[model samples]
Target: MLDAHLVKNLPDFKIDVNIKSAKGEVIVLFGSSGSGKTTCLDMIAGLVHPDSGHIRMGENTYFSSNQKPFPAEKRNVGYVMQDYALFPHMTADRNVQYGMKSVGKSEKSLALLDQFGIRHLRNAYPHEMSGGEKQRTAIARALAAEPNLLLLDEPLSALDDKARHDALTVITDIQRDLDIPIIMVTHNWTEAEKVATSIYKIEKGRLI
Candidate 1:
């Protein structure tokens, strides 16, 4: 399970939320901008430490006041950011391979690319692909390691209506293929309904 009861005080805002999610569950954190959705995600990924509280992800205790905090790289959680964050200089294959290399998963990475419908675009760079394609590549790269938890922050925010529709299907397909828990943060309620199994909303840092 991905469980966290974190408290963080930001300028002009504070975040205090409790979240619990497990395998086969895609929890959607839906709220307006600055509602601490992304902030809560960063905390779960160990990218940012909560001022106080324990974060337990299955057998791993990512953060605890009494134990050593897990580094971002060691959290065993895959995070896909809003911008897709692909390396402009690298080809799609390279980007996917970069992730595979981190976990000795090179042999199976191509299969994931094919699974996401971007295998042909492997040789193409991010600039060569459409916005939606780049985002799909990023998702495939994140799944290359088959992480225990998947966190996506407004991944479809930049896409137009048609792109959004296609991306949602891809996201759904990815979830169907993996048993891990997924936490998708977005302000789009329709996206949540289409992709999330359970909906969790945060308002002013509190899950309500």
Candidate 2:
């Protein structure tokens, strides 16, 4: 299970949330802008420290008030940010290989691109790819490390309706193929309804 309770104080607000999910579950955090939905995912990914509470992933304790939290990289989380966060200077294949530490980076990159159905665009840079292609590359890169969990933040917000639909299909396939917990943040109710196994809404820094 992926379980956590987070408490954090910001200058303008406070966040207190308790969430749990079994493996293969897709949990969508839905809320308006600045409702702390992204913050919740950040805490899970170890991108932000919680003021209190604990995070447990299966048998591992990722964070706790009494113990030092695991650093982001050590947490084995695959995070796909809203912008896709692709390396502008690198080709799609190289960007996907960035997280890999083993030999045959090129081969592994190509294989991942093939799995994501973007093998033909492997040589294209981020600027040369379309929105869907970039998103696929970002997902491939995130999975290169073989993470225990996946976090997607506003993934479809930048795409047009058709692109969003296509991306949603890809994301759903990923969740089904990988038996890990996926936590996604989005304000789109339609997206949430389509992908979420469970849904939580953040309001005034709390799950509503």
Candidate 3:
């Protein structure tokens, strides 16, 4: 299980939200822009330190006000950012291989590409691929690291209707296959209803 209580004082408002999800659950933080949804993910992913509260996944304590904050690199978090964030210069396969820690990185990356039905684009760079392809590549790269938890920030926001549908299926499949907790942030009500096992609505910075 993943449990977090994040408290951060932003200039506009303070973020104070508690989040919890078990394995195989897709928890969506549904909110408008600047509602602090992404900030919650950042704290859980170790990218941002909360002013107080704790982040714990199973037996691992990622952060706490009293203890030292865990280093981000060691957190083993798989994050698919809002923009996909694929390296412009790297090929799809190489980008996937970038986060892998296992042996046979090339083979693993290829397998993931195949799984995502983007094997044909393995050699293509981010600029050469469409938005959907880049999104799939980003997801593949995030999973290549075999993280304990997954964080997705508006993952399907850039896709067309068909692509969005396809990506939604892929996300569901991934959650079922990996049996890990997934925290996704999105403002789209339809998308949230489609993917979330549980939804938390946020306004300003508080869960409602």
Candidate 4:
């Protein structure tokens, strides 16, 4: 399980939320842009620090205001950003292996590519692939690290309807098979309804 009591002070508002998520659950933070949805994910992932409170995931303490914070890499989180942040110079397969340190990295990368149905695009660069393919590659890259939790920020916003539907299916299957908590941020209520096992609505930094 993941538990957090977080607070981050912004100029105009404060992000203060008490969040708990069970294993094998899909939790969606639903809100409009600038509503602190992504900021919450960033804090959980250790990309941004919370001014106060703490975050605990399973046996790990991810963050604490009084102690040293776990860096983003050590947090054991698989974060797929809004832009599908694939390395422009690396091939799809390479992107997946970027965070992998095990000797079986190649095999794992190939397996993830195949699992995401993008094995054929393994050698293709980000610029050459379609948006859906890029998204798949990004997700596969994130999972390659064998993270304890998955964080998705506006994952399907750039895809067409058909591609969006397909991506949703793939993500759901991954969550089920991995048995990990997934926290996704999205403004689309339809997408939230489709994937969220638990939903939190945020407005002006407060959970509603």
**Residue-by-residue lDDT tens digits, candidate 4, 1-208:** 9998889998889999988998899999999999888999999999999999999999889898778998998998999999988999999999999999789888889999999999999999999999899999999998899888999999999999999999999888987799899999999999999999999999989999
- Count of residue pairs whose backbone atoms collide, per candidate: 0, 0, 0, 0
Winner by lDDT: 3
TM-score, cand. 2: 0.96
Candidates' TM-scores? 0.94, 0.96, 0.98, 0.98
Tens digits of lDDT, candidate 3, 36-149: 998898899898899999999999999999999999999999999999989998999999999988789988988999999999999999999988999999999999999999
Evaluated with TM-score, which candidate comes out highest?
Answer: 3
- Poorly placed runs, candidate 2 (over 4 Å): none
lDDT of 2 by residue, 14-72 (tens): 99999898889999999999998888888998989999999999888999999999988
Better of 1 and 4 by TM-score: 4
lDDT of 1 by residue, 1-208 (tens): 8888889999878898888897878899999999999988899988889998889999889999888899998887888998988999998888887756455455576787888888889889998999889889999888875689999999999999999999899878878878899999999998999999999988989889
Candidate 3 residue-wise lDDT at 208: 98
Q: Which stretches of candidate 3 lie over 4 Å from their true place?
A: none
- Model 1 alpha-carbon miss at residue 89, Å: 2.1
lDDT leaderboard ranking: 3, 4, 2, 1
| RMSD in Å for model 2 | 1.1
Which pairs clash in the backbone of model 1?
A: none
